[model samples]
Target: MTREVSRTRLNMLRSYAAHDHRDNFQKAEMV
Candidate 1:
């Protein structure tokens, strides 16, 4: 159970990072 929870959390972090990266890329393009 603990392992599953950790895996889920890792996936969430990875997705969040990807989203943040995309946002930065968009802003860079606008500039």
Candidate 2:
């Protein structure tokens, strides 16, 4: 159960990172 929870958190982190990366790219492009 603990492993499952951690895995879910890892996936969430990955998605958040992806979103941050996309946002950063767009901001850089605009500048």
TM-score of each: 0.95, 0.95
Query: What is the alpha-carbon lDDT for the whole of candidate 1?
Result: 1.00
lDDT of 2 by residue, 1-31 (tens): 9999999999999999999999999999999
Give per-residue lDDT, candidate 1, residue 20. 100
Distance (Å) between predicted and true CA of 28, model 1?
A: 0.4
After superposition on all C-alphas, the RMSD of every candidate to the true structure, in Å, is 0.3, 0.3
Candidate 2 collision pairs: none
lDDT of 1 by residue, 1-31 (tens): 9999999999999999999999999999999
Query: Clashes in model 1: which pairs?
Result: none
